[model samples]
Target: MDSNRLVAGITVLARGSQTLGTAPIPNPADRQHPGDGLEGLPQAVPGAVGLCLSGGGSRALSCAMGQLRALRWLGKLDELFVISSVSGGSWANSLFTYLPEHISDDDFLGQPVLDPSQLSLLIGPHRLDHLPPHNLGEVPTRLGLWRDLDAILTLKERHGYANDELWQGLIGEQVFKPYGLWQPDASGHDPRYFTWTRRYLQGQNGILAHNPGLKPGSFLCVERARPFAIFNTALFSNDGPDADLIPFECNFQLGVRHNFPAQPSQQGAIGGGLLDAFAMGGRYLGEANGGGWVSSGRPARPFALNDIAGCSSAAFAQMLEEQYPVLSGLVPRYPYWPVAERAEQDTLHYRFADGGSLENLGLNALLARGLRRLIVCVNTDQAISRDPASGDIVLSDDLPPLFGLQPFQPGLGYLPYSAQQPGQGAARLYRHNQVFARQAFAQLQAGLFAARQAGGAILFRQRLPVLANDWFDVPAQDSVELLWVYNDFVSSWWKALPFDVRAALELESGGNFPRYNTFTQLELSATLVNALAHLSCWCLASDSTLGNQGGLSNAQMLTSMFD
Candidate 1:
């Protein structure tokens, strides 16, 4: 099908819109549609820069708040183009953006408020006047756990007493609203989706008709500069020990293009990214390939907002697979049953989980938003270490693909991208993978094996995902320079936290949280302050022009770091 006659929300937003009130900055092609939907990655709008927050439970978000305060102090708050996150980090980003006037920079800079144990996060000592119920449980009773578990497994129908209601009500309504993040609707069937994502743009309300004035969160918006949030979920399972975990992109700005055609999904008739407007319109769609509308023959149901979070978080599936002995008996299959994947099956679990479970950070997607300079705030502690026997200093894998490089490699010292072309060398840059050519890679590989045998940092490291270095710098740019910031404090704090919180705080990928881990606001504030201090140092070192410079413009810093 031609691109025009496709799904509603699936149409690309790189195009201009009424809400944006500006023409789109044209592109040779959309990275999403590169040579028919499957080639190069998503392309960023020119000069667009995005921030990616790593998942480390609530402390991570609190820490992010601290960093935001620092950026504001550095006179660089509005300079950010996008901010993406997963899990608690999402909670942090959402709260930070939605809050209104009178929010002091010091509110974030001050000491984090906490109780004695440093176990539960507190609300006061900052702008927050009270603590929202971060989680809800009437206490799974000796009388109710099994029955409720069964009811949950049943379609069991949705948001029943079993699950959805508690989270949407207690979590989003209770915790987030007082903080100014989410706004709910009374008339709508799903309150979680009733929120109006406040994009600086004048976005249309896709759900206004059903629950007048209420709208589905915008999948994409353009009016104001905002960070795109990301959540990770297991899309496909290996049927055994592994899962195909992927990131889900979130933007509350809903864009509806006039006279625009939608695309066909290779699989379902109701392709993904369907908006509430079409679903609520009661329009009978012709067929699956034509658009995202439901079949005329069968009713098209409104997709739940939780589907957004559910698919983005695969915690339930992990519980079943891992079957931790303590909670194994409570694992129910009936009401919330994982039915066969066949169409005939009544329903299926979306299996959503944290993005960090897939990649330690959602930096991969951030690269797609058009950033010449990429900065990642990591939780790994210490970039340098001393060898116990020799006293020679060694570097940790705080930053892979970059730190994986060691002295004495096969291709020789300098990484020359245009070695084949003479004067072209000036235009070429260092290759991300080739920087650790064959010999260097083998040496790193050997060292990893030795460490595994000795039970060092990582007993076994998964094969690293390929970096999209080629995508970030843009066509005219020479090289993608990376600034690695390590926070040693998180290691101690994370290691000190309880096993459940540790599971939730996983810096690298792990299972999901049946319920999120606990973290003190004070701890989050302190950790964030430390991270921001590190970030401030880096910015000051780079002359606070890190975002403005890239490629050859950053040659000096690149040369020092790479060498």
Candidate 2:
């Protein structure tokens, strides 16, 4: 830091402030002022205040408004000063409409805006000649320090007084030099490395500032004595007789949105030129979610799940083979063979100890463990299959036992002696099964409530035959109407419950949808995984009420329903 330059600037500013309100007016003939009545009369004791807006630009406007209101309440309106960029069109327009004009252009201003006050406005040019150029050749250099100093000097000449006590006191002192840039440790790398380093530095500074036992910047002194000594002088200064406001608090808000060009690129890249643009300048870079490349002004290459499909399948098989050898033996030779067969055969049954049965069990276990809280309601009954040769559909007792399930039977619908009651037979048995499924479903609903109490995310799946209820039928074999109906019902239930009572619910249908199975299971899984990666715990239900409850919470549920 150049002490002489800063002190000279401060001296001028202090003198200007004192001269503006209290000093005797100088005749227009005595100085360069016009012979108008306004000459030498400080214009209404022009007040000034400094404002710093930082972080997400437009997003942080509300916070800025609050800060402004607080300052007004504190009776600091007389000294209000606002510093913003020329690109801050929105904020500049807003402030100009509300604030009074005090002073104009200053040299340190990054972006200069024209104000109605006609006061001096400081505009800092983007120059980069003073600093040594190393790896920044590819980057466009903006205004350098020399231009910034010039702007500050210009502002002082316009408003500062040469003979004020504040001016003399500030200029007669020494100033400390602060580092222009921070360096990372050799061990640190890009991506999260920069974020961690910034956080560490902020924490260290905070600790020093807050520790009552030690003086300010004590820890900083231990690391860099020269800069610390300069800071100490500024902090403990008594020469000026009054504290001078710090002028260079660089804080501003920035908002950015991905803008893709209309013309599509001829390249075979997944996205377009937009991806390349984001890669170079997007706010979120070098982190886990920072792989989108900008090309032709668009996200040209986004991360895709197919990139890892082969590795994922191989890893999954290896994991299953290692963790559950017995079940692994039953797995088909080809990857995803079980799911493919499940879609093809329309035979929902598996022999008790066969690989097919094991697959189902494994799937159920995965759902139960991977999901926090789950509820399943199943309706099992015999289905008739036609013999083409005989042209007759024969009912068979071939329903498969549900995996991860215990034996259960539906009880009698009514008293056996009732006049409407028929003799105990097959018809009666079927009715009992239907009734049991509904009752079990009701019980599962209660269990969902219990799970939520235990701090678990809730999920529900309903599987019932079409004949069992009018609520669970599809118009076409491949139609998702039934699943949607169930989802809607569950959604309504979730909405009615308190936010803490119901977190999420899922509706699963066991029946096969021929048309919807056009895509291979592997392809579908890949797509599903890609979509699920973006899911967050925050859920927004109807009317945009944000909470942890309602809606489909699982990534699989979204993919299964929308895909």
Candidate 3:
């Protein structure tokens, strides 16, 4: 588990040979394609910065949009080496990464794309190509209700469908449809089937090729600086030995198809580690063939962004069958050939559920890569307390510890540490919880419940403890600085909003403006979405003091933390 051994696309056997269960003979020419693994992206460094986006359906999506825009405005977006997202946060990640080359910040966050008071401009008849209307005229801005129903029917007919697929389809049509990309289809008009293909990245005249600025190159290359994406999901098995190995009988896994480092046989083996992100799905075979492990899979439809999104957000897919039975396709499953011993036997199918089911914050992926500087944006309604008189969801003075509180909450702070002071089991940094002192936290808490709250976003900075186990190999840094970003409606920006605009938002949310309502609220009104987004943006970008405890804004603190 040495840190140096975690290089991308490398195998324990030799230069090229990779195996699932047993060591295979070395072979140099085993790559599936020229740039099969991590070639399209830069390698992650020990101290690189990573951003984690949490899971909260549409709430996370809107908050992430605002946060990302604010990050871009603060000139920190280009500095991010990795962005790990789960559930709704994955929606924003996919959209942000696939943006057309010409769309600038102004074009992205301006009037046409987002209008705070009006309905969502991204939906309905409005095309995302509005800034200068791109040549992708065939792509519709949004697939209307009936179109989606028809698409679902088609999908159900082809193969049994599920709730996750329906959710992913709607997300694609709404957010990513603007990019105008699709998997090659025979009918050529099936809007539900868009794809994230290698053709879009490395083709002679690919999307990235057409715009050299966004091309994959050196991480230091400012022209191509984009955060490597890691979307997380829980690999589930109700009855298997693997179930015992993982907590809740589910493993916290990532859908990072490229650049994932392979482990030695001492560690749990990953046959062939991970294939190309675009090479997933379809039929495949792995046989001895009297040679090293050789894999054979037909060029069937590969897993797209939507597929990953569906899997990552399938958190409630299993439990909500009684509510939406028609949409409950079998628990999201993926086929694997390496697990099968014989070629005649069927491929082993593994079930996948929501990443949040195992780790809601999406921090595992960044930590797995050994990144030491992290920003975790938690846009969840799960931690709220209700008011007795009103019975409405309200911000509680006692905020449950989201990260870094051991015995009380039992997370990162509770993990056994490898590095510690001579006589101490853990460093003071590892044991510490709140970023603010007791008095300061009390003051901040009071302000949160006051008639006029401070701001909608809250920030907590903690040093994440390095686990003693082999799962992480963060040798360069002793501890990680995790900036916790919470979604709360206590911002000065919220107080300053026009009365009419504020009222409309409150009405949409039934008076508890930023309750972020139910996690199942996948669809939201334009007003509520914009209000939350505006509040989120202001929390990061506004120059005003936050929490009534710190004179600096969240953006300023973020810059100084990285510096």
**Which scores greater on lDDT, model 1 or model 3?**
3
lDDT of 1 at 33: 19
Winner on lDDT (2 vs 3)? 3
Residue 445 of model 2 has an lDDT of 39
Q: Tens-digit lDDT track for model 2 on 366-434?
A: 111111111111111222233455443222111121211122223422222222652233222222112
Tell me how many clashing residue pairs each candidate has: 26, 53, 10
Best by the lDDT measure: 3
How many residue pairs in model 1 have overlapping backbones?
A: 26
Show the colliding residue pairs in model 3. Answer: 20-271, 162-329, 163-327, 454-491, 454-492, 455-490, 455-491, 455-492, 456-490, 456-491
TM-score-sorted candidate list, best first: 3, 1, 2
Q: What tens digits encode model 3's per-residue C-alpha lDDT throughout 1-563?
A: 22111111111222121121122211112323222332233344545678888777677777777778777778777677667887778766655655555655454543222223333234443322132233111122233335545565565565444444554454444445565433324522222322233432454533233233332431101112246566766553333423411111111112222211322311222232343332244334443232232333532343555666667766545544445566655356665322212234454455666766555666655654456788878787644333455443343211222232222121222232223521132122223222222323333234434323444347666664544222211122357777767776564555565566566666767776665654434456555565566666666665655552356666676765567
Compute the lDDT of residue 44 as modeled in candidate 1: 47
Better of 1 and 2 by lDDT: 1
Q: What is the lDDT of residue 407 in candidate 3?
A: 22
* Candidate 1 runs further than 4 Å off: 1-8, 12-45, 100-159, 163-177, 180-234, 237-242, 253-349, 381-478, 489-563
Per-model TM-score on C-alpha atoms: 0.49, 0.15, 0.65
| Candidate 1's TM-score | 0.49
